[model samples]
Target: MAQHPTDANVYFVPARSKAPIFASVSMFVMMMGVASWLNDVSWGKVAFFTGMAMMIATLFYWFGEVIRESQGGHYNRQVDVSFRMGMVWFIFSEVMFFGAFFGALFYTRQYALPWLGGEGDGVMTNALLWDGYSAAWPSAGPGQVGGHFQTIPAWGLPLVNTLILLTSGVTLTIAHHALKAGQRRALLFWLGLTVVLGITFLFLQAEEYIHAYSELNLTLGSGIYGSTFFMLTGFHGAHVALGTIMLLVMWFRALKGHFTKDHHFGFEAAAWYWHFVDVVWLGLFLFVYVL
Candidate 1:
């Protein structure tokens, strides 16, 4: 079923239809909905809901085309390699994106927070808050805006979640090898287990967030402390959700017998995303939670 690239009518899946338009229009609707929700506008909510609906429809049709092509065998070895490379680079960009947030966390705590404490120029406010605030990082003083929030200890649940993610990465690697070795049953078992682990990590994360908000009183409005904390951890959690969905799709594809020893770019793509999310969590634990 694979056609030569040079074939003008190449069964190479020029089966193009409404996917592009659908994806674009669907995204537009989502944006409108988001804008409305933010601004508290009536049409904004309407637009936002409409947009979400459109986007869901669009993704369904768009991915259907990809599935169709995959099922029809337009993707061969070369195509699979390209898909792998593309996913690697995509995850790399995402790493850099999270790194920016981490960088901001470092800068705010080390530089901006001190200056604001008036060690040099921020002397007035520092004197006001600490009566002689020394302008150091981890400003766990009365001057600290979230002065009341008890910082979550890193040795407990955060560390446990870290181990879970690291273990998931290993399980995923085993599953990938199983697939390549043509052990379908082992592959299915390991992959399904990996997805369950991912969901468990997310559930633990939700519990952590709840603890922070209700008992610790660490809120988003808690000032700079609240802001940076949420910005770093929230985005990482979002990536985890996305990575889980990618794995779930691959799981379903495996159920349908969609891949082979040499042609499973789709499965590999999901694995790549999962690993990327795993690595980001390590960074989050070390920098955001622990340090």
Candidate 2:
């Protein structure tokens, strides 16, 4: 039996479960499989897919259990607080993760390029290494590592995607407010719009990548610029995909009448993640594309 939401004194301590151990096993297998694949092992691809399937299955079961517990009223205010704190830390870790990549970009552009191009203390280095090599924003190094390449135009697909993401953020916020106000119809409509915008953004990004690779000669191998551009935008796309999935799930739950005006942390968590993704895209737009 589960307690009501008001019973905050009794913290629900779930029984010891095998989910954690299984999750660990899945991750270990997946990592090992990827490592092997990178090393060109014969069975690596099959092993990697197998491990991925196992991990996906494990997550599905684990999340289902948690959803059941939540809907059963096993979660009190304390549990809700714990969940909130957990989400906060998770987002914080993501911020750090992206920060490291951005830091690398900054270091390459500001320090490494200037130093290698004979600026200040690098005069001797430049004279000895490449003689007349000049520091530039999108250089492929003095050696021309990947030959000639062009950069994607910031005013084109990138701008469109930015607008789409910003609009999605607005729609998601509207959906959140609708959920909080007990307006199920508006909640579903706006959330569905957000999901559509997310998918559209992903489609445009794929088109951009295709254009970069086929026509523009911009690829991961192009130069430092290409690498950083792909890394930042690619990872952000993955996050957008994940956020879209979360929003879709929340939309389904909303259809099932699973949330209330006062008790809708699940919806709120998804909204938080979506907003974080939107903010990250804004940073990417300014730093990677426009600048």
Candidate 3:
């Protein structure tokens, strides 16, 4: 039920919610579960799944309340502006997050690897310390630290996932335009298509990871190459999963006629997030896979 305004001038002040606290606790549990699972704890997987379920439920209920508030016309132009600014900062922070991982990749490839191979510092460090060291991209460091592992070629699954993400960006933009043009049916259709693409991309990534682990023997323990490779791609995959869930929620809101042509920040925010994920994947594809 939408809230009817009694006074036009009063700004709506929402009561404090426990969503953030619940989210924090669930995240802590999830991390603990992950650490325990890595150490082969008996109940680790159970805890992880339980935490995941709790987090999902929390988000669903919290966002549903927010939707109700939105439909109730609680937010004003000022609130909308604040939402936009908040989203901008959130995306900016994500940029820095991925930037750190990329910076590590660059430093390792450009400086650390060369120095260890005795290319810089004008010292034959490889010969003096470790003989017959091969300095190559996708290398497992000196003496093949974690043994030999084949690198996944950039022309196959990775290229396919890249195309998929790019196409998703297009679909999402189309959906945004449809919303702005006041075409609800087209908006829902295109938004749902974007979610499907996101899911497909995740499925393909899972397949790729399985191939890397089983056929290529490229585990996280595979030294510098594998560590960086998995780190970048793994985090990106998690982002994609999150963005997909956001889109799904927006899709449901769309179906409920929760957005109008002039004010659909919820849809816009999800689109922004999805596009960010797409852009990050392009970076990973180029630096991690191609270069």
Candidate 4:
């Protein structure tokens, strides 16, 4: 067995290939799809579906590789540190992603909406736009594009999702503990259950989105309010989907006897991602739904 410098009992691993390439390819497909969608091209649906399919396929193959490497005893303490750092940076990037949306929400609500509402004696090119617009946090008007969605309330489905996420986080933590303790069966059970919880959350969120579009009158074209709402919550939902996939991958790897108490960077990395998504959703619930 290949051994670690710091711990001879633990194997040091360097086995990897194709994941980066696959991820890159998947990203390119997604970007192309998005661009096509934005430009109102006929191939938008094709691009979008192709991109998503590639991305999903890549994740499965890529994670299978990681699982194989882990079971083969390739990772070590040093590798664990690298994985941890990578996850941290990835979460940081996600934070910046949400930050941009939050900033837009802030600007629209605090400054732009007010000025357009003709509040506080503002002057300049705001006169014509203000004719029918009112100063509002949930801005819905002619000036506001796609401004019709009734804001999804924080007290209902959003809160339920929040609790589900929080509970899932707790379950994931328990699963981690089981892994660290070498309780393989327990770990797998909890991890699999966590994934179930995540899937349920996603399903509920989809239903909520449907309700918003059909009943609440909230839509992507309702204006800045709808746009921001969808952008923030939709992005968060995307993260949840990604996180759920990560957890499910982890569950399958555990079932395959991939991770041991002494070495499990792959599991750790997935856990980190799941936790990051949970935190991001919390922020979204508070800022986008409540505030």
Candidate 5:
């Protein structure tokens, strides 16, 4: 039976859950596999894929329980408030995560590079280490640290991907509006379009990476530029893929009439995440690509 508002005078607490433990173990195995793979262990790939499969399975089962509880109306106003607060903190954590990476980029460009080039108070240090070194925005350092490589122009695939992500943000907003207006057909159409745009952006990003590695001779080892380039854009790409999956799940749920106009916090949360991803891409385009 669906839980009524007055069914319980106190907040409902769930029984002990093993999902956290399961997830922890899965992550441990995954990280171990990654370390092993980096060291050239033959079975490392197998372990890595195995761990990923386990992690996906665990999340599906664990979240399935939450979904069931939600649909059963076990959640009260207090529970809803808790959910909102949890999401807020979760997104805040993500902001800090990305902020660290961006900070690294800024530090390398503003301070580290100039110090190495003997600017300001770095004169003696540069003379002792890298005499005649010139500081340039996209330099590979004194000895071409990781070999010479060309950069992908800001106006190429990067620009196109920017447009794609911006368009996705618009489409998702339209979908949200449609949901609120009870236009189920329009909601599904626009939401599906947003998912398509996300996938397209990923496809273009992969193409850009391919060109960088093959024709441009740019790999992860191509100095600090390559490292930061891959770190920022790569993480953002992963976020896009994740957001697409979330949108797909929401699309399926919408098809099944899971959300009503006033009770669609689930959809709202997913949309918020998608917009966050879009905003991060804009930062990447401006800082990593254009600048």
Candidate 6:
């Protein structure tokens, strides 16, 4: 049944949902599968894929239900405010998540590496552990953990990807403006272009990873540099993939005449997420690549 906007004072409370439980179960399965796979369990790969499938299916259904409810006018001003707050906090949590990883990188470079190389209070410690081990920006620890490896050049694919993401941000902004002005054709065109740019960025990143692993001998096992580099960039790539999907969904919704000028929190939320991704990528380009 549809809800009426006239009764806006009455808050709409949805029926209890099983989605949260299912989502938790799916995540548990996925983590267990990953752990098992890391430990060389035979069925771990299958279990991991199974969990991933379950999670995807669950999110599809859950999001569909929310979309239906929104389209049915079950959400009002209060709900809109709540959704905005939720997204804001969600992004804040993401910031903290990345902050931890960046902190690790900073600590390793600024303190740990220097200490291990006989700096400060580590002179005796270095003499005791591994003598003549000079501290370097791209060191592979004491024993050359995964052998010497070359880093990906910052001026190559990374710079191109940066430009691509920045361009996509501009396109998305144009699309948002067009949506507000009720220019359907321009909105779809720019949004579609933004999605294409996102896919291109992902493709380029995959190529960069391939080049690094095959030619440069850079990989997850290469060293702390390899581990942190991949961890940060890989996670950002995953976020970009997620943001691309969100924008694709919004494009479809816009095609179906879903959002009006005044009521388009769905589009706004996706836009906010996409912009956050862009900002994160800028940080990555500076710290992970350039600096």
lDDT of each: 0.80, 0.89, 0.90, 0.80, 0.89, 0.92
lDDT score at residue 167, model 2, on the 0-100 scale: 97
Model 4: ten consecutive residues of lowest lDDT: 1-10
True-vs-predicted CA distance for residue 3, candidate 6, Å: 8.1
Worst 10 residues of 6 by lDDT: 1-10
lDDT of 1 by residue, 1-291 (tens): 334454334335354476788778878878977887898977888887788788777777778778887787666555666677888899889988988988888888877777766766768777665566555544443446665676778898889889999998999999999999999899889999889998998999899989999998887766666777888888888888888888888888888887889888888888878888888888888887777
**lDDT rank order:** 6, 3, 2, 5, 4, 1
141-203 in candidate 4: lDDT tens per residue?
A: 445565445678799989999999999999999999999999988898899889999999999
Off by over 4 Å in 1: 1-13, 42-50, 120-147
Q: Score every model by TM-score.
A: 0.87, 0.94, 0.93, 0.87, 0.96, 0.97
lDDT of 6 by residue, 18-73 (tens): 89889889988888898999999998888888889889989998998899889988
lDDT score for residue 63 of model 1 = 80
Better of 4 and 5 by lDDT: 5
Specify the poorest-scoring 10-residue window by lDDT in model 1. 2-11
- Tell me how far the alpha carbon of residue 77 in candidate 6 is from the true structure, in angstroms, after superposition: 0.4
What range of 10 consecutive residues in model 2 has the weakest lDDT sum? Answer: 1-10
Compared with the true structure, model 6 gives a TM-score of 0.97
Better model by lDDT, 1 or 6? 6
lDDT of 1 at 170: 92
TM-score of 3: 0.93
- Residue 240 of model 1: what lDDT? 84
160-184 per-residue lDDT for model 5 (tens digits) = 9999999999999999999999999
